[model samples]
Target: MLLRLLLLICAPLCEPTVVFLRASPSQPIEGNSMTLTCKIQHAPLKSDAQFCFFKDGQTLGQGWNSFPEFQIATMWKENSGSYWCGAKTASSKAIWSQSIQIDVQRVPVSNVSLEIQPPGGHVMEGEKLILVCLVAGGTGDITFFWYKGALGLNLETKTRRSLTAKFEIPTVTESDAEQYYCAADNGYGPSLSGLVRITVRIPVSRPVLTLRAPRAQAVVGDVVELHCEAQRGSPPILYKFYHEDVTLGSSSASSGGGVSFNLSLTAEHSGNYSCEANNGLGAQRSEVVPLNITVPTEDRKELLTSGVIEGLLGILCPTTIALLFCCWLKRKIGRRSARDPPRSAPSPVPQQPTYLNSPDPVQQQPIYQNVNVVSGDEVYSLVYQMQQELQSAVVEPPRTRNEDKDPSAIYSWLKKANDTDLDYEDAM
Candidate 1:
């Protein structure tokens, strides 16, 4: 009892200057070799001081040794424990080193898998997406990395001693569409997971249908084209053209934009035309476009014949009226000529006798006695014969000026003859 008390009291005075335990590798894989060292700072380098190793408060070996190191050739899971060392001298109390815990882990990770929170990997744009990375058949703390195609995404690393790790994407967009994968590393190496494909679907917008024809009016036997498109839609869109709600034709735009269809127009094709665009999301129809087909005027024989008849009548009616007018004018002229006889040259006026001796000398006029009077029937026959001569002269293109004399002269001569006849009757 007295010796124990003295040892305890002197233990502090002769304690080693510094003592600590260190392992070559703080973490070691299973089946690897490692060395644990116990160092004493105050002891001589070649001192023969005996050292003893302890594991979890138990002695590892039966006795002490001059060396201050412990080696493990083949580490195992069971070899993980807290270890320390103690130094003893013949005249000093024993000194203990600080404790250190060693951990033996399994081999590096060999497999990694990624799974989406919502199965099938189909997600809407602007929605959150969760990805979970799983490590298979590995031990130790692991680091997980997320990747999109060949590019690395900005995701927080997971450094946990667990079999599964999670990575979250706040929002997804059209630009995020690509193949994704993950990797698991445990200091030894990294293992990549299988690729997962993601798709982003877009809804179809209102479609617009436009009609193109060779002329302002669609006619029979003319070719017409219909184009359909959407302002926004996904690729591989199916377009269907409709005429009066009947499907005329269909087309597809593989790269997305627009599609067109052609038709040989007929009379039956005149109706309200529209189109529909679909891309698996939904179908959208465009506003109705009116198409009118006209028939050519030459196609109907009855109408053509009636038009011809009306056109001939329109020409011949005016021509017939003009012909009757010319004939009436010619007959009126012939009758007027027959009533009036042509006037003979005016007779010379009688000359007044000049008498130089008297201021007032009486002028003497010559007096005619027996003038042969023409009968009315003879006058009518002479006027008719003169009219026949005038008509014959008009038929000949070239005539003298005398033959073309004014008809007014003939009228005056007739009046004079009537007056003279009245005077002669009075005288008788």
Candidate 2:
């Protein structure tokens, strides 16, 4: 105690006035608070004395302040460097302190996040897709992994010093749309991000239209259907049918496919037909299809006349054929009879005269001739087969010499005046 009191008087002359730089924590973790100080080694400085701090030959942003220390509220990896301090008085030359070194260790990664470019994860097909995995709080070299859904479905992995890693698809298709996430590790446990869903939109291609009818031809009153389809469009597609540029009808496919529109055909329905398909992006039209509708003719009067004419023809045709056949048969029989005489029956038989010829025209009675039908002939023949009828009630007189010699004398008066000769007909 007596030695310490004696040295106090000579302390100022013996020791030099120098400055020292010190740190609150020589090694600080990233994002932690830290502080640096400029200390005078010997006697106290004047009230007007100023101090400054530096890092690696560069000023630590505070220039000549009455305060002798610098404070770092948060430290980072980039803040690690050599540090020093300096001091000066209004009446004396400036002085500096020896440099000190501080290292701010990097914190382990946490809070991983997955994001998509053209945000919302809504992408069009055939376009590029970018997936970015971010580290909210991490330092040093970090390893990032992108997952579609679970860790088993790993999409990509990258190790670098960057805060974020990216996975890019040059051309995305429908199969690429799904849920995704990311995991980050910086010498620490892996941290997973929330799920991000991707939806792919496919633009409607050119549609195809088809017309189907119940019959071979599309006539009036026929029920036909128009089929419209877009081979590569997304869901809830709207289909519209047109005829000669006029809207006919519309239909939709909520689950994505083809649709049909039924049409009751009429005379006015005949025209060029087409169809269009849309899924909110844009509409596409199909090629024009020509349609023709035919209407039946109306002719009640002509139909009735034709029916009557057909009925008459149907009835008269057979009758005409029968008449012609009969006429031909008659001609054939007449020719046959003329060519060959009949063998079954005699030509004529002699008979007593039924009436005598009178000179007065009014007194003459009509003479009836008997007709016989020959089997092979067609014309009427005068046959005297009624000899028994003529002799039924007539009184008979004994034959005289002249009656015996000329039996045909009884028919003399019925003959013409030029016939003077008479001959007897032999009985067959």
**Maximum-TM-score candidate:** 2
Give the clash total for candidate 1.
0
Write one digit per residue (lDDT tens) for candidate 2, span 26-84: 99887777888888877676799999999888888658899987899888778999999
TM values, all candidates: 0.47, 0.50
Pairs with backbone N, CA or C atoms under 3 Å apart (clashes), candidate 2:
none
- Candidate 1 regions exceeding 4 Å error are 1-82, 85-103, 151-156, 299-428
Model 2, CA-based lDDT: 0.77
Q: For model 2, give the 10-residue run with minimal summed lDDT.
A: 407-416
- The TM-score that candidate 2 achieves is 0.50
The residue-by-residue lDDT of candidate 1 on 22-125, one tens digit each, is 88888987767888787878556447678888888888766588888888887766788998888877776678898989888877887799998677988777
